[model samples]
Target: MVAEAQNLKVSVWRGTGETGEFETFDVPSRESQTVLDVVSWIQQQADPTLTYRFACRVGMCGSCAMMVNGIPRWTCRTHVKKVSENNTLRIEPLRNMPVIKDLVADMDPFFDKWVSAEALHHPTSTRNDAITPVDATTPERQAADAGIECINCGICYAACDTVAGNPDYLGPAALQRAWTLLNDAKDGGRIAILDAVSGSGGCHNCHSMGSCTRYCPNELDPMSAIAGLKRETFRHALRRKRDA
Candidate 1:
């Protein structure tokens, strides 16, 4: 595999609860090898005590995200050659979250942010009522569909400095979901959702660092999503002011 002679020196974190060290391992590099493959090799060949979290080796699960070379990414899809620095790699837990152990960062807060964002849909029509049809090609739905493929990997949140600075900020993923729901013409909670994201710790809090968009694996622009939220919130505020 991969010429079987060269060695890759990798430094990985080990342990949990604020007690851990960067353990080094040497493994043979291979063609088209991903970062997850290298880490699995270390656990099987080098140290059995290594701790991490991974459900699927593919990118769909979004469970294998971590800090690769100080950038948040899905390790399962990340290639060794793409992230390795001078034949070495430093892997750690994702930022802005609790480290469970080694590379497994706790995702509880990340999910909670989703709940706080109120990104869920609330149907106004009863089940007995006539079904309403929506055109998928509409401008609003099309804009919503552009960034709707997010896998909730938390990479955007980890890469966001606004989330790191203000714990109350809903972060990009949740806001992206909110955008999707808000654009749905049939959703009854549009005004409520606007109210939710327009207040303190809302869209105005974003500093536009663009790290979330820069590091997204799916090529989404959460920065743009946040800007859109700002505009919508301002429009809603002006409407309220005029009504008052």
Candidate 2:
């Protein structure tokens, strides 16, 4: 199908530091067009000074996540045809993050939360041990695979209401990462990682809104990953109590 290219009334957020507004522009829309394409058109034709962030135009990098029409979405995949109601688009930076510029959000806290959740892998098995292989289709790997495709895009973090309410909350991405590591048979940091995320602003804070799952471009279920965390933490806590 030859998609029609219509004129779109676009609104791009401008400026930062407590002063910003949606500057309107006339953008050309086309068939199979994405929100990123619209923003790129504006940057190319309407205003060269408009600042936004995007690395890979594809959905892998997760750097193109933003607030599109009041919802967090990966601009690379969000089709304007589906989201635009009246040939109008409102683009803004992701929520709950510091705006470095117009549509660019600071992601320092997002990365820091991964560390806070102890999401990193530590070696447990020695090289001298017999080599072990993992079956990809096994229930354990499948469970870990549920949330394994995260590009660290922070869409889940920004969309999460719990993260907005509590600045210290580890958020879905971090918690999901922690869950994956916890399930990894080779990871030595499982116990410590669980302890880290079991504290204040951890998995317990998740409200089960599933905003992370809803907003995930990769379709990973973060809520399920978090639920797994809660279960594991509770089980481990009880085991410790029994030993005490």
Candidate 3:
């Protein structure tokens, strides 16, 4: 038994998919320790076979996102002091994703939705064509700028309740990316992109619960982007009806 003052009681999910069980560990408490540091310590000092993922420890790379105390966060940036309750921490793989192993959630489905949303930019000009000068101050550019900082971390995807309940939902990150591309003046796939997200499983499925925005490490507002897509798709539908 660990003395309550010197050690942290950490309960970590240990298995694949829904078959996991929480394995508790008592780790020595330290000042200014990040959650990623704690996991690294566990893997290094306590258990060597523990599976997890991390790249840049400084939080630039979004590869270290995990569920800390029931909330999705970039583990590298999450200080243990800020989240631990009574010197206890609960660490697990991100929610709404298939667990490949302990702390490593498969991101294929999350990215698949990105592809389904047609979030990639389709350039209007060929390489040989002159570069199109875009005014950064334009409303479209500003809208695009607001959402272009996403690092594909999957934190927003994990926090989305729509993704949890609706398998077909395109999700906040993907929809937000689509919105950025939609506003890009040089993107040529606007029609297809709009069509992709206009489906029943797309932006319209969002409940605007703001979970994505609330948990995003990059401070992006995916909810606002989804709202924009909703408005744009509605206008497109109205135009289609008039043209019919």
* Top candidate when judged by lDDT against the true structure: 3
- Give the per-residue lDDT of model 2 (tens digit) for 130-239: 75676788877888877788899999999999989899999999999999888776677988988999999899999899999998889999999999999999999999
What is candidate 3's lDDT per residue for 78-196, written digit by digit as tens? 99989999889999999999999999999999999899999987989989999888889999999999999998889999999889999889899999999999999888899999999
Q: After superposition, how far is residue 203 of candidate 1 from its true place, in Å?
A: 1.6
Q: Kindly indicate the candidate among 1 and 3 with the higher TM-score.
A: 3
lDDT of 1: 0.86
Report lDDT (CA) for all predictions: 0.86, 0.89, 0.93
Q: Per-prediction TM-score, please?
A: 0.94, 0.94, 0.96
Query: Sorted on lDDT, highest at the top, how do the candidates line up?
Result: 3, 2, 1
Those runs of model 1 whose alpha carbons end farther than 4 Å from true positions after fitting are none
Residue-level error in angstroms, candidate 1, position 72:
0.7
Runs of candidate 3 exceeding 4 Å displacement: 1-5
Q: In model 3, which range of ten residues has the least summed lDDT? A: 1-10
Model 1 — TM-score against the truth?
0.94
- Record all residue pairs in model 1 with backbone atoms less than 3 Å apart, i.e. clashing: none
